[model samples]
Every structure is written in structure tokens, then in C-alpha cells.
Target chain A: MASRMRIRAKAADGVTEVKALMSHPMETGQRKDAEGNPIPAHYITEVTALHNDKVVLQAYWGAAVSQNPFLHFRFKGGAEGDTVTIKWVDNKGESQSDDTKI
Target chain B: MNHHRRTFLKLGGAAFGAVATAALWPLRAIAAAVRPNAAFEATALDGAYKQLGGTPAESADIDLSTPDIAENGAVVPVSVTSKLPGTEAIYILIEKNPNPLAAGFMIPEGTEPFVSVRVKVAQTCNVIAVVKAGGKLYSAAKETKVTLGGCGG
Candidate 1:
């Protein structure tokens, strides 16, 4: 899907806060337009978060999820100015990654 | 600057500030807006989050409340309260949302077990709470429904 995403992250005192939002139709296969045409699947399948290249968080999702997904999570053992990066990819093979400092 | 231009600039800047703010505020507000379907969806179960260890959730007693039926799909009130000691973090998730993740809070050690926010939910689903106490993950969840639909919601 031709959509954009925004991510924000902060790490400190051995803990981190990471939030993300992705743009997509998130069309559930069950959805049908006015013409009653089935909307094919379009939604995020994987999300990953890393701290200095060390895997920290990840999840798998399905179309049952809502549109423009938003997530908030935390990390441990981090300090100020530490780099927190997040990456997300949908079933359609669209993906993006960005990072922020604590 | 002429008086009228100055007035216009002042007025325009003020107006611009309001309009610009309104435009930008909704971006986060819309993303964080909560809906009915935001309840009952499981969170952090996929081990998608960084954990203290192999144990992703610690399961302390907590209360995550949303109206079983929400009137507005745009901004639903969600609160999480934990009875666990040394509560450091409380993360909120809208289970059925496009992302199934809503707001993540980094609670200071002394923070009360409760945190509330407006989240966006696209359908009917559960909301989950993942609490961290003394460096471990614990959680609970419930279901809510969204009746009104659309961006106006």
C-alpha cells in the first residue's frame, strides 16, 4: 500500500519507550466495496525494534488488525542518547525503518 | 509593517497557529484515538516486545477498563491500574486495530498503576495492558466495541 509511517523512540535508565504508526488500507479480506468486490489482504505482517542492532522487540500480525496501526512499548537497560530503531513490513512487501535517540 | 499588515500578521499568525496546530494535533490525536473494538485483543503475546528474558509477561493483577460499548470511535478513554509492587511501566494496546498497539507509557518507579489516553481503533477488539514491575512483564485485557464509523468519529 502506498502509505507512510511515523516512529518515535526514547531510551533511558535501562528502559526505553518506542512508539510506531504505519499507513495502510489494512483491508481485511472480509471487506467488500460498494460493488461487493472483495478487498484483498493489505496489512502489516511483521514489526521489529532494535537497540544498537541487538533485537529488542518484534511481533507478527494479521488483517484483523485496524488501519494505521499504532503501538507503544518499552525497553530495558538503556541510557540517554542511545539509538532505538524500529522496522515494519506488510504482507505486500512494503517496509520502512527509522531511529531516535533516548 | 503597516498597522493593518501588523494586525494581519498578528491575526494571521494567531490564526495560522490555531489552524496549523489543529492540523498537526489531529495527526497524533487521530493516531491515538480509541474505539470500541479496541478492547479484548491480546497484546505482547506474540513476544514482539523486548522482555527481561524468556519471560515476556509477568501477569500481575491489574485493571484495564474501557466502556464495553463506546459511543465515539475516535477517542476512547482507556486506563490501566496495577496492584503489583514497584510498577515501572504500563503499556496500552488496541488489540484489533491496524497495529494492535496504542500507547506505551514509561512509568517512573513511583508512578501510580493508572494511565489513560485517547486511542484510535478501527473495529471491535480487546485492549491490553503490559505492566513492568522490578524489570518483568505482566499483563491483562478486555473487549470494547465501536459503533460510529469514519474520520469524523
Candidate 2:
């Protein structure tokens, strides 16, 4: 699947701030369609970030997470021009990964 | 029995895969040690807390930011920052949702003890931020009034 994350990473004072917006429906199983059929649960189950090939952050999500989730975090040890990779996997096994330079 | 062994092997393989994908990060250990699927499905705060394996101690060091009133329950911005040292993990929970545990984050060393994300609110309820630091659980909560419900709620 195509990467659906919009990521931005910036470095300052030996720290890197990473922000990302992920596009997803995040449908809860209880939600019904216009015809009133229940929608199956479909939401990002996990999200991870790697900085310079080292794991930095990981998040576990549930159906309660909002659609098109936004995430922001910061870490030390990344320098200018370093690479930060973000990846996510949904309950349906769909996945997306993308990288940005700090 | 053959069936038991097969199930164990499948679980072992899944645990290995989760670790390898993260390069054996510390967070992998925490995630592997605890399987919170039941917690996520729990309908009550106490039930979710029980599934998490520990009771959180309310603290003032956690900075939980949420709006006083959410115009739409479909999307509510939630952020948490822990002033406590040795912070390792953060969790967002909504008191009234069918599944109270919205998300969990593992914070590695040298990473700021801060996380921000959006959550779906089914109704007016208390939003809680639980932080695990130094092997102890601490939490802060704030009430958010939802003017309009969302998530088919």
C-alpha cells in the first residue's frame, strides 16, 4: 500500500522534533453504515519510528483512536541530515512506511 | 498436545516478529511482556486498569492537555507530558468509551516524555493520561464535555 503519512522532522540543540499525520478511516466496529450495517473494526494497531536505523518510538493504538491520527514527539541524539523513518500497521494487516530527513 | 504446542509456537513466532521489526527495542520487551487486548476491549476504567496489571497513582507531575469542551466527539486532541524522571510509557484512556484505553506509547531513553495524538470521544467523560516511570504508574485526568457525539455512538 502507498505510504499515507505526512512527516516533518527538524533538528535543534541536539534534539529532533518529529510530527506526522497519518491518513486512515479508524473505523470502530460499532459504527454502522448509511444502511445501518455494522462496520468492521479497522484502525492502526501499531506505529513505530526509527532514527538513524535505531528504534526511537512505538505506539499501540485501538479503535478509540481518531481518524487520520496526528502524532508529535521529540528525541535526543539525532543531528541535522539524519534520517527518521515512520511506519504504521492497521488491524487489517495494511501497512505504510515513510522517511524524512532531519 | 499437538494443538497446545502449535499455539505456543504461533505466539512465539509472533512475538519474535514484533521484536525483529523494532530491532529489539526496549519497547518491544514491554509490549511483549504485556498483552493488553483485553484492556482495550474493557468497558470500564477499573476493568481496563485491572487488565493493565496495576493501579495508577494520581499525580500532579503529569501535564494532560485537552480542551474543556470538544465541539465534535469525532476528534479530540490529547497531549501528555510527564515531568517525572525515568518515564518509560504513556497511555491515553477515556472513561466512558466502550474501550477505555485509546492508545499506549513506549518512550525510550533520551526521548522527551511527551506524546500528542487525537482520540475519538463517544460522550462527555474524563480523559486520563497514565505514565509509567521508574516502574511505578502515575496518572492525571481531565473532563471533556462533548457537544456532539461521534464514532457511531
Candidate 1 local lDDT, residue B79: 65
TM-score of chain B of each: 0.61, 0.77
Question: Across residues A1-102, which tens digit of lDDT does each residue of candidate 1 receive?
Answer: 354457676655655667666666655555576797877867666666677777665444545444666666565666777787777777689887777776
In angstroms and one decimal each, the interface RMSD of every candidate reads 9.0, 1.4
Worst 10 residues of 2 chain B by lDDT: B27-36
Which prediction has the highest lDDT against the true structure? 2
Per-residue CA lDDT of candidate 1, range B46-96, in tens?
A: 533432223345464888877788776655667677788887656666655
True contacts kept of each: 0.01, 0.87
Query: How far does residue A57 in candidate 1 sit from its true spot (Å)?
Result: 0.9
TM-scores for all candidates? 0.50, 0.86
Kindly list the per-residue Cα lDDT of model 2 for residues B1-153, writing each as its tens digit: 999999999999999998788885766565633436887888899988887768899999999999999999989999999999999889999999988999998898988999999999999999999999988889999999999985745
How far off is residue A40 in model 1, in Å?
0.8
List of chain A TM-scores, every candidate: 0.85, 0.94
